[model samples]
Target: MRAATGLWRWRHNPLRRTTDLAEAWIAFAAAALLCVVVPLTGWAAGSSAHGSLQRAVRTQQEQRVPTTARVVRQADGPGSGPRTADTAGEERLRRSVVARWTAPDGSVRTGTVTTSRRQSAPGDTFPLWTDRSGHPVTPPMRAGTARAHALIAGLMAAMLTGLLVEIVRRLAVRRLVLTRYARLDRAWAATGPDWGRTGTGS
Candidate 1:
Protein backbone atom coordinates (compact mmCIF):
# COMPACT_ATOMS: atom_id res chain seq x y z
CA MET A 1 0.00 0.00 0.00
CA ARG A 2 2.69 2.45 0.97
CA ALA A 3 4.65 1.57 -2.12
CA ALA A 4 1.63 2.05 -4.35
CA THR A 5 0.88 5.36 -2.69
CA GLY A 6 4.45 6.50 -3.13
CA LEU A 7 4.37 5.46 -6.77
CA TRP A 8 1.34 7.64 -7.39
CA ARG A 9 2.64 10.51 -5.29
CA TRP A 10 6.06 10.53 -7.01
CA ARG A 11 4.79 10.14 -10.59
CA HIS A 12 5.00 13.92 -11.27
CA ASN A 13 7.06 15.09 -8.31
CA PRO A 14 9.93 17.23 -9.66
CA LEU A 15 12.30 16.05 -6.92
CA ARG A 16 11.66 12.32 -7.37
CA ARG A 17 14.89 10.45 -8.11
CA THR A 18 15.07 7.70 -10.72
CA THR A 19 16.04 5.19 -8.04
CA ASP A 20 12.97 6.12 -6.01
CA LEU A 21 10.71 5.48 -8.97
CA ALA A 22 12.50 2.20 -9.67
CA GLU A 23 12.11 1.07 -6.07
CA ALA A 24 8.43 1.93 -6.06
CA TRP A 25 7.91 0.05 -9.31
CA ILE A 26 9.68 -2.98 -7.93
CA ALA A 27 7.44 -2.93 -4.87
CA PHE A 28 4.34 -2.61 -7.01
CA ALA A 29 5.41 -5.52 -9.18
CA ALA A 30 6.09 -7.68 -6.13
CA ALA A 31 2.69 -6.81 -4.70
CA ALA A 32 0.97 -7.69 -7.94
CA LEU A 33 2.72 -11.04 -8.15
CA LEU A 34 1.82 -11.80 -4.56
CA CYS A 35 -1.80 -10.99 -5.23
CA VAL A 36 -2.09 -12.94 -8.47
CA VAL A 37 0.62 -15.57 -8.90
CA VAL A 38 0.74 -16.88 -5.36
CA PRO A 39 -2.88 -18.04 -5.13
CA LEU A 40 -2.75 -19.46 -8.63
CA THR A 41 0.37 -21.45 -7.84
CA GLY A 42 -1.19 -22.76 -4.66
CA TRP A 43 -4.41 -23.77 -6.40
CA ALA A 44 -2.52 -25.52 -9.18
CA ALA A 45 -0.36 -27.47 -6.78
CA GLY A 46 -3.29 -28.43 -4.60
CA SER A 47 -5.44 -29.55 -7.52
CA SER A 48 -2.67 -31.73 -8.88
CA ALA A 49 -2.00 -33.25 -5.51
CA HIS A 50 -5.68 -33.85 -4.93
CA GLY A 51 -6.09 -35.64 -8.24
CA SER A 52 -3.14 -37.91 -7.58
CA LEU A 53 -4.23 -38.67 -4.04
CA GLN A 54 -7.80 -39.40 -5.07
CA ARG A 55 -6.55 -41.84 -7.66
CA ALA A 56 -4.43 -43.55 -5.06
CA VAL A 57 -7.40 -43.71 -2.72
CA ARG A 58 -9.48 -45.36 -5.39
CA THR A 59 -6.77 -47.88 -6.18
CA GLN A 60 -6.31 -48.73 -2.54
CA GLN A 61 -10.02 -49.14 -2.05
CA GLU A 62 -10.24 -51.53 -4.95
CA GLN A 63 -7.21 -53.59 -3.94
CA ARG A 64 -7.93 -53.77 -0.22
CA VAL A 65 -10.84 -55.48 1.56
CA PRO A 66 -12.14 -55.09 5.06
CA THR A 67 -12.86 -58.44 6.67
CA THR A 68 -13.71 -59.65 10.13
CA ALA A 69 -10.91 -61.64 11.80
CA ARG A 70 -11.52 -63.75 14.87
CA VAL A 71 -8.80 -63.75 17.45
CA VAL A 72 -7.27 -67.17 18.10
CA ARG A 73 -5.18 -65.98 21.02
CA GLN A 74 -2.88 -63.20 22.22
CA ALA A 75 0.45 -63.12 20.44
CA ASP A 76 3.03 -62.57 23.18
CA GLY A 77 6.49 -63.55 22.09
CA PRO A 78 9.95 -62.08 21.61
CA GLY A 79 8.91 -60.08 18.56
CA SER A 80 5.41 -59.37 19.81
CA GLY A 81 5.12 -56.12 21.73
CA PRO A 82 2.70 -53.24 21.87
CA ARG A 83 2.86 -51.83 18.36
CA THR A 84 0.93 -49.53 16.06
CA ALA A 85 -1.63 -50.58 13.50
CA ASP A 86 -0.52 -50.62 9.91
CA THR A 87 -3.51 -48.48 8.94
CA ALA A 88 -2.88 -44.73 8.65
CA GLY A 89 -6.05 -43.97 10.60
CA GLU A 90 -4.91 -45.98 13.59
CA GLU A 91 -2.01 -44.26 15.30
CA ARG A 92 -2.56 -45.52 18.82
CA LEU A 93 -0.87 -48.43 20.51
CA ARG A 94 -2.31 -51.84 19.67
CA ARG A 95 -1.77 -55.37 20.86
CA SER A 96 -0.70 -58.15 18.56
CA VAL A 97 -3.06 -61.06 18.25
CA VAL A 98 -3.20 -64.33 16.34
CA ALA A 99 -6.36 -64.17 14.25
CA ARG A 100 -7.99 -66.13 11.46
CA TRP A 101 -10.08 -64.89 8.56
CA THR A 102 -11.18 -65.87 5.08
CA ALA A 103 -9.42 -64.39 2.06
CA PRO A 104 -11.16 -62.96 -0.99
CA ASP A 105 -10.46 -66.24 -2.73
CA GLY A 106 -12.48 -68.10 -0.03
CA SER A 107 -9.31 -69.58 1.47
CA VAL A 108 -8.78 -69.48 5.23
CA ARG A 109 -5.98 -67.14 6.27
CA THR A 110 -4.47 -67.02 9.72
CA GLY A 111 -1.84 -64.55 10.81
CA THR A 112 -0.75 -62.15 13.51
CA VAL A 113 -2.68 -58.91 13.36
CA THR A 114 -2.55 -55.67 15.34
CA THR A 115 -5.71 -54.50 17.05
CA SER A 116 -6.62 -51.62 19.34
CA ARG A 117 -8.85 -53.89 21.42
CA ARG A 118 -7.05 -54.13 24.75
CA GLN A 119 -9.09 -57.03 26.10
CA SER A 120 -8.57 -59.17 23.00
CA ALA A 121 -9.25 -62.82 23.67
CA PRO A 122 -10.13 -66.01 21.83
CA GLY A 123 -13.00 -65.66 19.38
CA ASP A 124 -13.13 -61.88 19.64
CA THR A 125 -13.79 -60.58 16.15
CA PHE A 126 -12.48 -57.25 14.86
CA PRO A 127 -12.33 -55.51 11.52
CA LEU A 128 -9.17 -55.96 9.51
CA TRP A 129 -7.97 -54.85 6.10
CA THR A 130 -6.17 -57.27 3.86
CA ASP A 131 -5.06 -57.54 0.28
CA ARG A 132 -6.63 -59.89 -2.24
CA SER A 133 -3.98 -62.49 -1.43
CA GLY A 134 -5.08 -62.40 2.27
CA HIS A 135 -1.98 -60.58 3.52
CA PRO A 136 -2.71 -57.86 6.05
CA VAL A 137 -2.44 -54.32 4.73
CA THR A 138 -3.11 -50.78 5.81
CA PRO A 139 -6.53 -49.25 5.41
CA PRO A 140 -7.33 -47.05 2.47
CA MET A 141 -6.82 -43.33 2.72
CA ARG A 142 -9.94 -41.44 3.75
CA ALA A 143 -11.37 -38.66 1.62
CA GLY A 144 -11.09 -36.09 4.39
CA THR A 145 -7.45 -36.96 4.98
CA ALA A 146 -6.65 -36.58 1.33
CA ARG A 147 -8.33 -33.18 1.29
CA ALA A 148 -6.40 -32.06 4.36
CA HIS A 149 -3.11 -33.06 2.76
CA ALA A 150 -4.06 -31.20 -0.38
CA LEU A 151 -4.86 -28.09 1.62
CA ILE A 152 -1.49 -28.25 3.40
CA ALA A 153 0.30 -28.65 0.10
CA GLY A 154 -1.52 -25.65 -1.29
CA LEU A 155 -0.66 -23.49 1.71
CA MET A 156 3.02 -24.44 1.54
CA ALA A 157 3.20 -23.66 -2.17
CA ALA A 158 1.55 -20.29 -1.69
CA MET A 159 3.92 -19.34 1.11
CA LEU A 160 6.94 -20.36 -0.97
CA THR A 161 5.73 -18.34 -3.93
CA GLY A 162 5.23 -15.28 -1.79
CA LEU A 163 8.67 -15.74 -0.26
CA LEU A 164 10.35 -15.97 -3.67
CA VAL A 165 8.63 -12.81 -4.91
CA GLU A 166 9.66 -10.88 -1.79
CA ILE A 167 13.23 -12.09 -2.09
CA VAL A 168 13.50 -10.97 -5.73
CA ARG A 169 11.97 -7.59 -4.92
CA ARG A 170 14.35 -7.03 -2.03
CA LEU A 171 17.38 -8.00 -4.12
CA ALA A 172 16.36 -5.59 -6.90
CA VAL A 173 15.78 -2.77 -4.41
CA ARG A 174 19.15 -3.46 -2.78
CA ARG A 175 20.90 -3.25 -6.15
CA LEU A 176 19.18 0.05 -6.93
CA VAL A 177 20.18 1.43 -3.54
CA LEU A 178 23.77 0.38 -4.10
CA THR A 179 23.82 2.08 -7.48
CA ARG A 180 22.41 5.26 -5.95
CA TYR A 181 25.09 5.19 -3.26
CA ALA A 182 27.83 4.67 -5.86
CA ARG A 183 26.63 7.67 -7.84
CA LEU A 184 26.55 9.77 -4.68
CA ASP A 185 30.08 8.67 -3.82
CA ARG A 186 31.31 9.69 -7.30
CA ALA A 187 29.67 13.14 -7.03
CA TRP A 188 31.16 13.67 -3.54
CA ALA A 189 34.62 12.63 -4.76
CA ALA A 190 34.49 15.12 -7.67
CA THR A 191 33.68 18.08 -5.40
CA GLY A 192 35.56 17.07 -2.20
CA PRO A 193 38.83 18.86 -3.12
CA ASP A 194 37.07 22.14 -3.93
CA TRP A 195 34.85 22.31 -0.85
CA GLY A 196 34.81 25.70 1.08
CA ARG A 197 37.14 27.34 -1.45
CA THR A 198 36.75 31.10 -1.78
CA GLY A 199 36.25 31.02 -5.58
CA THR A 200 35.18 27.46 -6.23
CA GLY A 201 32.03 28.60 -8.14
CA SER A 202 31.14 31.71 -10.20
Candidate 2:
Protein backbone atom coordinates (compact mmCIF):
# COMPACT_ATOMS: atom_id res chain seq x y z
CA MET A 1 0.00 0.00 0.00
CA ARG A 2 2.79 2.36 0.98
CA ALA A 3 4.72 1.56 -2.19
CA ALA A 4 1.62 2.18 -4.35
CA THR A 5 0.89 5.50 -2.58
CA GLY A 6 4.47 6.65 -2.92
CA LEU A 7 4.51 5.72 -6.62
CA TRP A 8 1.24 7.57 -7.17
CA ARG A 9 2.58 10.71 -5.48
CA TRP A 10 5.83 10.52 -7.49
CA ARG A 11 3.90 10.27 -10.77
CA HIS A 12 1.79 13.31 -9.91
CA ASN A 13 4.67 15.48 -8.65
CA PRO A 14 6.82 16.50 -11.62
CA LEU A 15 9.53 17.91 -9.35
CA ARG A 16 10.34 14.43 -7.95
CA ARG A 17 11.02 12.93 -11.39
CA THR A 18 14.50 11.43 -12.06
CA THR A 19 14.41 11.70 -15.85
CA ASP A 20 14.98 15.47 -15.87
CA LEU A 21 18.19 15.24 -13.83
CA ALA A 22 19.55 12.41 -15.93
CA GLU A 23 18.83 14.25 -19.18
CA ALA A 24 20.43 17.49 -17.94
CA TRP A 25 23.63 15.76 -16.86
CA ILE A 26 23.90 13.82 -20.10
CA ALA A 27 23.47 16.97 -22.20
CA PHE A 28 26.09 18.89 -20.22
CA ALA A 29 28.65 16.12 -20.48
CA ALA A 30 28.07 15.65 -24.19
CA ALA A 31 28.40 19.38 -24.88
CA ALA A 32 31.67 19.53 -22.98
CA LEU A 33 33.17 16.59 -24.86
CA LEU A 34 32.18 17.89 -28.29
CA CYS A 35 32.92 21.59 -27.79
CA VAL A 36 36.23 21.07 -26.01
CA VAL A 37 38.10 17.75 -25.90
CA VAL A 38 37.48 16.33 -29.39
CA PRO A 39 38.48 19.39 -31.42
CA LEU A 40 41.69 19.93 -29.42
CA THR A 41 42.90 16.38 -29.88
CA GLY A 42 42.04 16.36 -33.59
CA TRP A 43 43.84 19.64 -34.23
CA ALA A 44 47.02 18.40 -32.54
CA ALA A 45 47.04 15.13 -34.51
CA GLY A 46 46.37 16.92 -37.84
CA SER A 47 49.27 19.35 -37.34
CA SER A 48 51.61 16.43 -36.76
CA ALA A 49 50.46 14.65 -39.94
CA HIS A 50 50.90 17.83 -42.01
CA GLY A 51 54.47 18.28 -40.76
CA SER A 52 55.38 14.65 -41.53
CA LEU A 53 54.11 14.82 -45.13
CA GLN A 54 56.10 18.01 -45.82
CA ARG A 55 59.36 16.46 -44.62
CA ALA A 56 58.93 13.29 -46.70
CA VAL A 57 58.26 15.24 -49.91
CA ARG A 58 61.33 17.44 -49.42
CA THR A 59 63.71 14.50 -48.90
CA GLN A 60 62.48 12.68 -52.02
CA GLN A 61 62.69 15.76 -54.24
CA GLU A 62 66.27 16.48 -53.10
CA GLN A 63 67.55 12.96 -53.95
CA ARG A 64 65.88 12.99 -57.41
CA VAL A 65 67.11 16.44 -58.53
CA PRO A 66 70.43 17.58 -57.05
CA THR A 67 70.88 20.64 -59.31
CA THR A 68 68.57 23.41 -60.56
CA ALA A 69 68.34 24.69 -64.20
CA ARG A 70 66.97 27.89 -65.74
CA VAL A 71 64.22 27.97 -68.40
CA VAL A 72 65.05 29.44 -71.84
CA ARG A 73 61.45 29.74 -73.19
CA GLN A 74 58.20 30.38 -71.34
CA ALA A 75 55.50 27.66 -71.51
CA ASP A 76 52.12 28.43 -73.09
CA GLY A 77 48.88 28.76 -71.05
CA PRO A 78 46.63 25.84 -69.95
CA GLY A 79 45.91 22.70 -71.98
CA SER A 80 47.28 21.99 -75.50
CA GLY A 81 50.09 24.52 -75.15
CA PRO A 82 52.72 24.42 -77.93
CA ARG A 83 56.02 22.76 -77.02
CA THR A 84 59.28 24.60 -77.68
CA ALA A 85 62.74 23.27 -78.55
CA ASP A 86 65.53 24.13 -76.11
CA THR A 87 68.15 26.56 -77.53
CA ALA A 88 70.67 24.71 -75.29
CA GLY A 89 70.39 21.79 -77.79
CA GLU A 90 68.67 19.61 -75.16
CA GLU A 91 65.48 17.57 -75.68
CA ARG A 92 62.27 19.60 -76.24
CA LEU A 93 60.66 20.82 -72.98
CA ARG A 94 57.27 19.53 -71.88
CA ARG A 95 54.68 22.33 -71.78
CA SER A 96 52.68 20.81 -68.96
CA VAL A 97 53.92 19.75 -65.49
CA VAL A 98 52.27 17.56 -62.84
CA ALA A 99 53.07 17.36 -59.12
CA ARG A 100 52.83 14.03 -57.33
CA TRP A 101 52.42 12.96 -53.70
CA THR A 102 52.54 9.55 -52.06
CA ALA A 103 49.68 8.51 -49.82
CA PRO A 104 49.92 6.57 -46.55
CA ASP A 105 49.23 3.32 -48.39
CA GLY A 106 52.36 3.76 -50.56
CA SER A 107 50.24 4.79 -53.55
CA VAL A 108 51.43 7.70 -55.68
CA ARG A 109 48.85 10.40 -56.58
CA THR A 110 49.28 13.15 -59.14
CA GLY A 111 47.88 16.61 -58.61
CA THR A 112 46.36 19.01 -61.15
CA VAL A 113 48.45 20.16 -64.14
CA THR A 114 50.25 23.40 -63.32
CA THR A 115 51.60 25.38 -66.29
CA SER A 116 54.31 27.79 -65.37
CA ARG A 117 55.84 30.51 -67.52
CA ARG A 118 59.17 28.73 -66.83
CA GLN A 119 59.51 25.61 -69.00
CA SER A 120 61.13 22.38 -67.84
CA ALA A 121 62.96 20.23 -70.42
CA PRO A 122 63.00 16.43 -70.33
CA GLY A 123 66.68 16.18 -69.20
CA ASP A 124 66.82 19.45 -67.25
CA THR A 125 66.66 19.18 -63.42
CA PHE A 126 65.46 21.67 -60.83
CA PRO A 127 65.37 21.71 -57.05
CA LEU A 128 61.81 21.30 -55.71
CA TRP A 129 60.60 24.13 -53.47
CA THR A 130 60.58 23.75 -49.67
CA ASP A 131 59.69 25.94 -46.73
CA ARG A 132 62.26 27.03 -44.11
CA SER A 133 61.80 23.69 -42.36
CA GLY A 134 62.46 21.77 -45.62
CA HIS A 135 58.84 20.74 -46.09
CA PRO A 136 57.18 20.57 -49.49
CA VAL A 137 54.02 22.60 -49.83
CA THR A 138 50.95 20.69 -50.99
CA PRO A 139 48.88 22.54 -53.58
CA PRO A 140 45.08 23.01 -53.91
CA MET A 141 44.04 24.63 -50.63
CA ARG A 142 40.81 22.54 -50.48
CA ALA A 143 42.51 19.14 -50.65
CA GLY A 144 42.01 16.62 -47.86
CA THR A 145 44.67 14.66 -45.91
CA ALA A 146 45.14 12.70 -42.72
CA ARG A 147 44.31 15.84 -40.75
CA ALA A 148 40.90 16.09 -42.39
CA HIS A 149 40.20 12.45 -41.61
CA ALA A 150 40.98 13.00 -37.94
CA LEU A 151 38.65 16.02 -37.73
CA ILE A 152 35.82 14.11 -39.41
CA ALA A 153 36.27 11.22 -37.01
CA GLY A 154 36.10 13.60 -34.07
CA LEU A 155 32.82 15.10 -35.32
CA MET A 156 31.24 11.67 -35.81
CA ALA A 157 32.25 10.62 -32.33
CA ALA A 158 30.63 13.73 -30.84
CA MET A 159 27.35 13.10 -32.68
CA LEU A 160 27.22 9.42 -31.71
CA THR A 161 27.88 10.20 -28.08
CA GLY A 162 25.03 12.71 -28.02
CA LEU A 163 22.67 10.18 -29.58
CA LEU A 164 23.52 7.45 -27.08
CA VAL A 165 23.11 9.79 -24.13
CA GLU A 166 19.66 10.85 -25.31
CA ILE A 167 18.62 7.23 -25.78
CA VAL A 168 19.54 6.40 -22.18
CA ARG A 169 17.55 9.35 -20.88
CA ARG A 170 14.46 8.25 -22.80
CA LEU A 171 14.75 4.72 -21.42
CA ALA A 172 14.92 6.07 -17.88
CA VAL A 173 11.73 8.06 -18.43
CA ARG A 174 9.95 5.01 -19.85
CA ARG A 175 10.96 2.88 -16.85
CA LEU A 176 9.64 5.50 -14.43
CA VAL A 177 6.33 5.64 -16.25
CA LEU A 178 6.01 1.86 -16.32
CA THR A 179 6.72 1.54 -12.58
CA ARG A 180 4.06 4.15 -11.75
CA TYR A 181 1.48 2.45 -13.98
CA ALA A 182 2.16 -0.92 -12.40
CA ARG A 183 1.48 0.52 -8.96
CA LEU A 184 -1.79 2.05 -10.13
CA ASP A 185 -2.81 -1.29 -11.58
CA ARG A 186 -2.11 -3.09 -8.29
CA ALA A 187 -4.05 -0.48 -6.28
CA TRP A 188 -7.13 -0.85 -8.48
CA ALA A 189 -6.88 -4.63 -8.41
CA ALA A 190 -6.83 -4.66 -4.58
CA THR A 191 -10.03 -2.59 -4.40
CA GLY A 192 -11.87 -5.48 -6.10
CA PRO A 193 -15.31 -5.17 -7.79
CA ASP A 194 -17.64 -2.59 -6.25
CA TRP A 195 -21.34 -3.37 -6.79
CA GLY A 196 -23.90 -0.59 -6.72
CA ARG A 197 -24.66 0.32 -3.06
CA THR A 198 -27.04 2.99 -1.76
CA GLY A 199 -29.88 3.26 0.78
CA THR A 200 -32.45 3.93 -1.94
CA GLY A 201 -31.20 1.22 -4.33
CA SER A 202 -33.26 -2.00 -4.50
Error of 1 at 193 (Å): 1.9
Clashing residue pairs in all predictions, respectively, total: 0, 0
**Across residues 26-144, which tens digit of lDDT does each residue of candidate 2 receive?**
44555565567656655665566666655655554443322222333333443221223432232233244544434334444443232333646544433333223322332212234
Model 1: per-residue lDDT, tens digit, 139-159? 789988999999999999999
User: What TM-score, to 2 decimals, does candidate 2 have?
Assistant: 0.35
- How far residue 100's Cα lies from its native spot in candidate 1, in Å, is 0.5
Instruction: Mark the 10 consecutive residues where model 1 has the least summed lDDT.
Output: 77-86
RMSD of each: 3.1, 12.7
Worst 10 residues of 2 by lDDT: 79-88
How high is the lDDT of residue 1 in model 2?
39
